[model samples]
Target: MATTEGDQKLDKSTPEGAWKKLLSAQEYHILREKGTEPAGSGQYNKFYEQGTYVCAGCGTPLYESETKFNSGCGWPAYYDNLPGAVERHEDRAYGMIRTEITCANCGGHLGHVFKGEGFPTPTNERHCVNSVSVKFKPKE
Candidate 1:
């Protein structure tokens, strides 16, 4: 088996059962089980601080503070992500087509990205991420 770059960041020695024990029920559900937290109920929904946002599962830097914006969509909104920080896939769940974003390093479900919603961003795109899927590291 080849040890990919992603495999180096996240500890793979831990078994699935150990991961269940390592994370909380909610974190497990959102990060591992591909579940979503309720909108407007996230810690980062209204949080704006000077720092970088990293993946909760693997601590890979995903977004910078300057990329964040207030979309009033009840979630942490970013105009962009750090280069190659996340991967996008076609999500066709729940009778809807959406672009699903996940941590490139750990493959944890971050949230979805949407475009053409009329947001004043350089790319006119929105990376709507789940708070539980990320951790904020304040600049020091």
Candidate 2:
């Protein structure tokens, strides 16, 4: 079986059904069902190695390591994403208006992006992503 840079398996068939079989339950829950993992529990929340963050569902390169920062909000936070990698949609679930970020390639839910939080990064935005939705590929 061929794997992506993040080591996530790829299925070239129809996404609607193939994803359910390709991804794990947790990955499907968050990636397909727009579920969020508990804060501070994701593996990449505290991990600070040089790497690229890719979508777990399709393995599309989404975020770069340099853009990641310690925002203390839990669930790996990034200040920016790779160009043309992520897509933002208006998410009004849970009685709150938020911008949900997803993999542009596979339409997999990654997490939400919070803006105007006054972060020190170039963009005052925090991309709070679930670890189950992404995988790390260390720089070679």
Candidate 3:
């Protein structure tokens, strides 16, 4: 993605320590440490209010409310993201070859993106993101 502090990897080379200092324990775990919130427990799992979702780490606009959908996956699901708002990487964690999504601005771990589940979205993609990894700004 375009060069941005958030686009860089969260590691020792980056200002991870500074980010940790600014984030809560939960936020740090989910965003910086690439952890997942328990399904159905995230604040945004059932939230459908009109808003734009931004990266929790660096406040980068990521997804719009129009793209949000009910995927019955117990997490905030989106059909798409703002262009260049996120970057995808091959995640081999837990022996699964899934695509991991990270904020293009702050490089915080948002969650995974899946496809071919017959979703009725234009892209047929499900961006299952952790609520803690993002913040909502209701359209005014």
Candidate 4:
């Protein structure tokens, strides 16, 4: 962490307060407060570069680029997540029930999962995620 503001440094090795120190206000809001970014406003919404999408709060690999698809639903849409990388919970906010996905290792909010969408993907699921909650690491 930088003593001077705006000079952010991520100390990813530590799990305690590391995310709070590293994530920006907007990132923290979505990842910690479970806030959602405006539709079609996320950076990863249309991105198709080969990489892995990891939890921005904890650096844990969450989704693979191969699983990504253009669902035209605004936010980044994936057919599946990396096995065991995410945990699902029943989200009952806004009077509707939805499955919320979070980073398994850090408990940071990723987004919601919608199944039975009838997409051509192997898994008929769409993991709607906020770009601020995740970061992309290009394949090596």
Candidate 5:
């Protein structure tokens, strides 16, 4: 799939043209513009099966099932990311202090990371991810 950062203008010819045809304006907005869906409404929040989560926008493998944990934060949470799979940036958007996480391969927004979660995992980090940003692939 053709991936681009920020808002992707529909050219009305390529396969993305079909995607533009299929997805709603909001889906296009969040997937392409790195917009966040409302916290409690994400589909991945309750995904509990054993699987791998990949970037919805680019199909990049992001997090493994073993790393996922219940953070009770109303979103899919992970203790760590796949090595070199995601990139971080300083985000000052919406007048808040936070770091933005994006897929290293496609620059699609994944979520944010924060410290001091105190999870038993080696990394005491919490990767609070958006459900819309990922697709779950069940294990064999």
Candidate 6:
């Protein structure tokens, strides 16, 4: 992968450049380039907090703190998303098939969704999100 000077380190020197400076290459790839960070490796899997999770790319509101749940899948799981805030696509990457979710506004890759979540919620959907793709703002 070609690394731009911007890609070497997150340009966190300014609030506007924080995302670029704080995130790693893989994080930049998955979050900004719409690539997938390998599952079972995201930090949000073990995150238990009360906060709103916003898109790391554009700061768009995506999931509420209340919607988060543990799927035991080593990834951050949510039963729902903020209405009309995301777009889905059929991802055929790496010879495997999965549904890809992206931020509706900036088109930054969030993660994939899977069915059969076994949750009692109406959606029964599991939105497996990447931690690098999101930033949690805890409720006060």
TM-score of 2: 0.90
Q: Report residue 4 deviation for candidate 4 (angstroms).
A: 17
- Pairs that collide in candidate 1 are none
Global local distance difference test of model 3: 0.89
Clashing pairs in 5: none
Poorly placed runs, candidate 6 (over 4 Å) = 1-24
After the best TM-score superposition of candidate 6, give how far the Cα of residue 86 lies from its true spot, in angstroms: 0.9
Once superposed on the true structure, which residue ranges of model 3 sit more than 4 Å away at CA? 1-14
Instruction: Please provide TM-scores, in order, for all candidate models, with all chains considered together.
Output: 0.89, 0.90, 0.90, 0.87, 0.80, 0.77
* Candidate 4 accuracy as lDDT: 0.86
Candidate 3: count of backbone clashes, pairs at least 3 residues apart or interchain = 4
- What's the true lDDT of residue 73 in model 4? 96
RMSD per model, one decimal: 4.0, 3.5, 4.0, 4.5, 5.2, 6.6
List ranges where model 2 is wrong by over 4 Å: 1-13
Tens-digit lDDT string for candidate 4 (81-135): 9999999999999999999998887778889999998999999999999999899
What count of clashes does model 5 give?
0
Ten residues in a row with the worst lDDT in model 2? 6-15
Q: How would you encode candidate 5's per-residue C-alpha lDDT over 28-133 as one tens digit per residue?
A: 5675677888877988887788989987766678999889988888888898888988888998888998888887776667778888867877799888888888
Answer with 2 or 6, whichever has the higher TM-score: 2
Q: How well does candidate 4 score on lDDT at residue 133?
A: 88
lDDT of 2 by residue, 58-108 (tens): 778999999999999889999999998899999999999999998887788
Of 4 and 6, the candidate ahead on lDDT is: 4
lDDT of each: 0.86, 0.88, 0.89, 0.86, 0.77, 0.77
Task: Please count the clashing residue pairs in each candidate, in the order shown.
Answer: 0, 0, 4, 0, 0, 5
Residue-level lDDT tens digits of model 1 in 33-102: 8899999999999999999999877678999999999999888999999998889999999999999999
